[model samples]
Target: MANYHRNNVENVVLGRHHHHSHRSKSASVAGHTFRLWNAASFRRIIFDAVSCGASSRYAARSNISDEKQHLQQKQQHHKTTSMKNNAKSEKLSDLLSIAEAETDVETKKKEEKLEDLKRLVKELQQHEEDSTKNKKSEAAAKVRLLAKEELEVRGTLAMLGAIPPLVAMLDETEQNDVNSLVSSLYALLNLGIGNDANKAAIVKVGSVEKMLKLIESPDGLDSSVSEAIVANFLGLSALDSNKPIIGSSASIYFLVRTLQSLDDESSPQAKQDALRALYNLSIFPGNVAFILETDLVVFLVNSIGDMEVTERTLATLSNIVSTREGRKAISAVPDSIPILVDVLNWTDSPECQEKASYILMVMAHKSYGDKQAMIEAGIASSLLELSLLGSTLAQKRASRILEILRVDKGKQVSGSYGLGAAVSAPICGSLSGKPDGGGGRECFEEDEEMMSEEKKAVKQLVQQSLQNNMRKIVKRANLPHDIVPSDHFKSLTLSSTSKSLPF
Candidate 1:
């Protein structure tokens, strides 16, 4: 039983060992399955991890590209903003330059305007200062009556020195002020200072030209202005050296016209004054020709015909006839002889007759036998007729002509005859006969008429003797003593048988 129990124990122990072995196997299998499952799970997890890693890398790359794009856009925006700022800066610079240029131009204009205003103000101030100084000096000079007059004279002289201002006053639009100024200037000129410098100053002021305009103005002038102008011109005329001023063509023509326009009936004094001025002007040789070139000759000749104008006209004619130019001027007028003869015939005044006869004598001297030519031109008979009613002046002038002819005849008789003698002799011989009345004499009712007629007869005799003597003088002038008589009076008797009168 022990043996069996031991065996059973062995069996039981074997069975237990087998069961332990099976369990050991089952545990091994389970451990292997678990190991395989863990391996697969780990492999799967690794794969998943790798895949996720790749996806995350791709996402990161896309995110990086987006970030780069955003950065580039921001850079472009910054560049555009910077360019706009630069453009604004350039525009502001251009506007600033234009504003500066405009400001400079306005500033220059203002400066120039300021300069002009300063100059004008300076001139005005100077004028006021000079005027005030003059007034003060004048007040200081007024001490006594004689002293005052002396001071007044000095003041006038000073004012005359201030001719620039006085003349400028003429341009003022105010008429009364202009007149007063002009009047003051006239008084200054007439102040008997006789300062050549002052006179020259007045001339420089253009007062002469202005005064002439006042005379010619259609509106006329105040009497004082007229008188002053006349006086000024007369004073200037007396300054013979100033005669060149008359050559100013405008001045000369105006003076001539002014003289012509004066009515002898209305303003005889003015006429006389004008005549005197003309006479003064005539003293200039150039003015003589200029006067003749105008209607002055005709006007003067017409004036001579007027009773009122006779004396002055004669005086003027005498002045004109004294020069070589005067001779030419007298000869220029074709009707001068007849006009002069008529003047002689109408006037019984000694002075008038003397002047007329003197003019004739001058003509005789110039014309020689042309005196006969004048008679043949119908002037000689009238001249002889005029001589029949001569005054003492006429007789003297007539006798003077005869004496000249006689001297000429004495010289000419050295030759038998000359054209001058031949022309003069017959006209002279014709006067040797009696008058139309009996006994070679005529009676007149009026004592004055008789005196005139007697004077005329004496003039005629003198003229005849002059003509005969001129013939002898012409004949003798070209001849030897043998061919022509030394004494012409002894050679030829007064007879109609000698030669026929040309006329």
Candidate 2:
């Protein structure tokens, strides 16, 4: 039993050992499986962990890649923004340049406007200065003119005193100083000192010729210079009639030509002086026929119409009709009697009235027709009225005409009245009854018949006389008389009438 039990125990021990080995192997395999499984699980867990870790790592790597890509995208976006910012800065710079150019153009326009204003102001200032200068020049010219006038007056006074030095100074003076010189010469001529000897001295010095030449000079010699020259020449002409200094033919021609030349429209004073010179020349019997043959009578008649010198003209006409030659010269005119009668009736001035009356008296003494014409012209009645209504000079002239007419009437009883018989009968009345009647009574009846035959003859004669008188008055007053003076008269005997000449 012990043995068996031992055996069993061994067998059990072996079986147990076998089993334990199997169990150990199984446990080992299981442990291996468990280990494998654990390992696998661990490996799975590890792998999962690893895979998770790897995935996490990969995720991390992916995240890192995404972050890097995002970072790259952000970098690209930042670059684009920087580029846009740069472009905006460039556009602002261009706009600033345009504004600067516009400002520059505006500044230039303002500057130009300022310059234009300055120029206008300067021109205005210049114009004002020029106006002031012109006014000053005008004032200076007036002052100079006054000074020249005063100097002439003083020089004239000195020359009249017979100051030799003053005369010499005038001779040596420049032509521009002729105003004073001419004034002095005029005064010396008026003084009438040192008669023939002084005149001879002046002629020797060529003063007469110089004075003549001065008429055409531009120095504005006075009208008196012409008068002085005329007097000097006339005196010289009279003094040496046999030995002419300025040649007799030349002198006469020059005088006549000068008289005509003085009739220029610009020279009133020259015309007056020329007329005076002609009057002096006419007084010379030697020149009377020559003057009458020329245009001297017409010129004188025209001068009678001059307003500036009618008084001198009337005196000249009166002087012309007084002498025998003068009467003949006057009769040569176509209508002299009517003209003179007209003058007598028209004027109110005492001097003019006297002159007209004087002419009428002379005409009445000339011929039977002249007396008859005067009577028919109402000149006889006009004379009577004038005698009643005139001054002493006019009344005396009218009385003379009446006496001449009375003489003419008395002469008509004897025969055809001669001028001498007509003049003598009224003064003495002795010739009135004288038996010297030739054709005078017949001529008287014929004159009466002729006077009655013409229609309104007496009225016409009176009307013409009054009209002519009005014209004479107008001429004397320097006015125009276009209307007939007789148009206002109503009477037959005392009224203005037209006269017809029997001759």
Candidate 3:
């Protein structure tokens, strides 16, 4: 037991010695590192001292070992390299940090801009709904400005569910209230200017009738408002489905009255707008007879010299004279045939040329073929050009008319058959009794007698005034009034009720 106790004491002594030795070794390495750094400074001092005595061999004989000096220089170089590497890493870290910070700032700025756009759109929509008049007007002006940038916004309001409410907003305003009314029109115009779906949506909400009613309001409503309504109507009616709806008899009649109310001599813009609306409405063939009942046919035909009005005028007439009664009514206007032929030279539009050519073709088939007035108005040459280069339909009509006009009169007298000759037969039979040697006026007077009392007075007055105008227009064209304007000048025929023309 005593030997074992002695053995444990000896082991403990040995362990302590081992730990002390290891601690001493670590301390020695640290001391050596510090001393090496100091030795570099001392070597410089000692070299200076030796240089003062000029003793190179004495400096080499100093106490420091060569291996220890080499070790000290190695350690110093390693420490300097490590510090330079750390400094370079710190600079790179700073640059990376700056770049990351700049990227974060740009991302936040973009997010803020997007948020501002959303807020602006939402605010404008809210302003549109405000109860206060000023707020509503402000919203309207704002939204109008926004919609003006439709390419930028692309119906952003549509994304925010603002279109239908805007359509309904038109219902809340009075046509007489200029601010409220104009605002609604502006919004609707912008809204309708969106994609086809947006326009179809506007139409789906029954805007055609609303716009027409605003248009039909008396001249007392602000002209700007009326003009806006007409402009909006034009855009909406551009859709084919909207055309039939707005082209109803009542609306066409209203449009014609609107035209009559505008003085072509003074209010040219008003006349242009109203006439264009009527022109668009005339696309529906079913509405032609209703338009005929109004004095609009004579009105439009008379106004054809206005370049602003001529294209639409000829276009509407092209649709009108497509009907049998329409051709006869249009034939009654002294300026109609001549004006249609003149459109070919003055207008650059091929459609205008085609329409005018087609009208001449129809008139030739009905009455104008045999008339020296149509031939004098330069119908022959226009028909020739269109016969060759016009649309296929216009080409066919022009070819037939040329045959009628170019063919021998002896064949016509003998009832020789052609499309124009066939069409002229029915109208010629009706015109044979007129004062123009057509023998048709006595029949017109008889038909006039059969009309209602109110109709008789209006018809006589309109007839007398128109006859005077016809005489002047015919004289200006240097043609006999009796030849160009057919004798049953101011009357509607009750017998010809067919929608399609006799042709």
Error of 3 at 273 (Å): 3.3
Which structure among the candidates has the greatest TM-score? 3
At residue 440, give the lDDT of candidate 2: 57
Residues 1-503 of candidate 1 have per-residue lDDT tens digits of 34434654565566556656665433345344111235785576567666666777898999999999999999999999999999999999999999999999999986774554344223322343545534322322221122224534433433424445444433332344334544444544554245555556656667677666665677756555555555566666766666667445455665566577645322555556667777777777777766666777667766677777787787677767766667666766677766776666554466777787787778677666535534434444344444444665576566555444433553421011111222111112223365554422333234345434444443444446445555544654775434533466434333322122221
Using lDDT as the measure, name the better of candidate 2 and candidate 3.
3
State the displacement of the C-alpha of residue 437, model 1, in Å, after optimal TM-score superposition. Answer: 49
Error of 1 at 148 (Å): 14
lDDT of 2: 0.52
- Report the number of the highest-lDDT candidate: 3
lDDT of 3: 0.62
RMSD of each: 31.0, 33.5, 22.6
lDDT of 3 by residue, 74-128 (tens): 9999999999999999999999999999999999996775565566455445634
Colliding pairs, model 3: 431-438, 432-438, 432-439, 433-438, 433-439, 433-440, 434-438, 434-439, 434-440, 434-441
What is the overall TM-score of model 1 with all chains considered together?
A: 0.46
lDDT by candidate, in order shown: 0.55, 0.52, 0.62
Give the total clashing residue pairs for model 2. 19
